[model samples]
Target: MTSEADLAWIASVVGDPARLRILLSLMDGRARTAKELAFLARIAAPTASGHLAKLLDSRLVAVEPQGRHRYFRIASPLVAQMVETMSAVAGDASPGDRRLRRIDPALAAARTCYDHLAGRLGVAIADALQARGHVAFGDGSGEVTASGRAFFAALGLDLAEAGHGRRVFCKPCLDWTERRHHIAGGLGAAFCGHCLSAGWIRRHRDSRAVEVSPEGRVALAELLGVDGQALTSGWPERAAA
Candidate 1:
């Protein structure tokens, strides 16, 4: 149970601009070192260490030690969801940033939200699933249908193997840029991984934006009925169209 003290602690932890920056950098499901986080947060390494310690103590971040290096990532899916939702709320309350608008088209076309696919491609996939009766959406949630199991199984993602985790199984995450819901949760991450491995999409070298392949267009059309080409063409195309 969360007490008021717990809420206050979390509020304080995430309230700092430097700490918030560090957390946002780790939101893409990548474990980063203190040095990298320091650079991203524009703080000294020593200051980053202090922020990291506080985040770690608050259980908002987790550390994994590999050899001589320790990497940090958001502690859990719940934390990721909280950060994402808060971002959406904040975006809603403010005038959109002019700088972000400059790159909005690219980000809207394809981008990553934590470990899952987001942006147009993500929303398209989610829409496809619901259209085909492979999934269902509720207020702010979603569930995989029996057909979803068969569909994903054919694609080589054994839903059963997604397994038990502190992460959610299947759910809709509101996309901040697109103003639509995209998949996020264990299933979302798995879907994104499968797409990457299959060469259907490739990440940009210096951006969170992803590019769709020619082959990916056909595959998405044939498999999920998603029009990847149209998405890349800078237009919003729904599966039904």
Candidate 2:
């Protein structure tokens, strides 16, 4: 069970907008320098340093030092989940919250939830997998079926290798923007990695939004029967590029 002190500390660490921005920036599973986070949060270096120090002390974030550089990232997958869930719960936009409202469309289209995909594209992939009998869902979790194994193998994904980690093999994450279920866990991460390596999706710098490339459109359409053009139809030219 969690103690009151733990809850209070979590609240305090996550309560500040600047720190929240820093954490959100690290949600893509990449370590970032203080300078990068400072730029993303639009705060002064000194102020960002102070905020980072607090996050480090609270164990909400961790750092690695290599020569003259220090990179920081969320402490663990658990930490990432906490931040993502909080972002989902607090996602309702106020009438005057123009900044968030503007980012909403892009975020819903294609974005990372920690190491896995969680957005329209993510939800679509999940649906395709289930529809084709590639995966089975039950009791809030899921597992790849035999046909699913064969399907991923054709794409060069070895489920055995992807399941080598200590994390759960497969699970469902509620998409905050889509309000639908997308796959999470080891399988989800592997699929995301495969898409990235295959040039099926390109991630935006300093942002969670991803763009599905033309090649990706063809591949997804052929493999999963997903309408790639329709998926990206609403995206601006800039986003597609």
lDDT per prediction?
A: 0.78, 0.79
RMSD to the true structure for each prediction, in A, is 12.6, 13.4
Residue-level lDDT tens digits of model 1 in 1-241: 5698899999899999999999888776677899999999999999999999999999888776656777787775457667766777787622222333455677778888998999878877877788889989764467888888889888898676674667688987766554456889889988988989999999988888898888887898789765556554433433254
lDDT of candidate 2 at residue 199, scale 0 to 100: 96
TM-score, structure 1 vs. true: 0.56
Weakest 10 consecutive residues, lDDT, candidate 1? 93-102
Worst lDDT run of 10 residues, candidate 2, spans: 232-241
Model 2 per-residue lDDT tens digits across residues 1-241: 4798888998998999999899888776677899999999999999999999999998888776656778787765457667656766788533323333444667778899999997778877887788788988775578999999999988889889888968898887766554456899999999999999999999988889888888988988788875676554332212322
- TM-scores for the candidates: 0.56, 0.55
Best by TM-score: 1
